[model samples]
Target: MISKDPRKGGLAGRVTKLSNSEQQNNPLHGVRLDAILEELVAKLGWEELGKKINIRCFNYDPSIKSSLAFLRKTPWAREKVEQLYLRTTKKGRK
Candidate 1:
């Protein structure tokens, strides 16, 4: 029997991970989730990052561990974070 839990693979019972070739051009390909969270926290602080993302993990009693757990299971939220990271870093390069 397959689990209906999203954390347990969701209704599909599995998730597809992108292959190396597929992520080759991605700036966040090799970036670890923890590192992303850490950098965002460092650069934006929980208050600003929370305001930007509007996520509970960043808004209330935020911590790297809690945020990581939430973001790992939540793809959309993770994507938002990665996009924010890219945008924030891009500005620094100029």
Candidate 2:
């Protein structure tokens, strides 16, 4: 049965997909993995994030090369950084 609504399923669910505006907020999207780490290090600072999160990457003067390698392999650390980014951005609004 053909639906009358033209918008029924034509990329309807894709609306939530990455838009250009949102793409700006995503540090990792379309970015080199090493670059993402560099930005995180620059913005958050390794010492501060290390103090807060107690992760090895932030603790040991870790390089973008090593951190990128670790984060790519470890889902849990990636999740932690994503969560931190969300929290940090949310706080910046106030």
Candidate 3:
């Protein structure tokens, strides 16, 4: 049965709708974590990334697979990486 109220579908439906709306506004929406790492490495190199983000994965012994694993588990580090990507690319776009 269809509900007249949007919230009547409950939490899952509301979360899905919120997610879709957020995706529309997020530049990193459809972008993969690996892709973001790859682009950052390509543009900045491991040394620079480590300098900027100060993460052990990028500093000590970097590999795309390892970095991806670390970033996936570490939200703060992942957010730093995404912010760097956005900041760097935004300037280049101009």
Q: Name the best candidate (by TM-score).
A: 3
Q: List TM-score per model, in order.
A: 0.74, 0.55, 0.75
Model 2, TM vs. native: 0.55
Q: Which is the winner by lDDT between candidate 1 and candidate 2? A: 1
- Clash total of candidate 1: 0
Clashes of 3: 0
Pick the winner on TM-score between candidates 2 and 3. Answer: 3
Higher-scoring candidate on lDDT, 1 or 3: 1
lDDT of 1 by residue, 1-93 (tens): 233666656586645677678777577767888988898899899999999999999988999999999998988999899889888886334
Q: Which of the two candidates, 2 or 3, achieves a greater lDDT against the reference? A: 3
Q: Candidate 1 has which clashing residue pairs, if any?
A: none
Ranking by lDDT: 1, 3, 2
Candidate 3 deviant stretches above 4 angstroms? 1-19, 91-94
Task: Report the Cα lDDT for candidate 2.
Answer: 0.67
Cα displacement (angstroms), candidate 1, residue 54, comes to 0.4
Cα lDDT tens digits for candidate 3, 1-85: 1124555545332222345766677787768989889999999999999999998899998999999999988878998998899
Candidate 3 overall lDDT versus native: 0.82
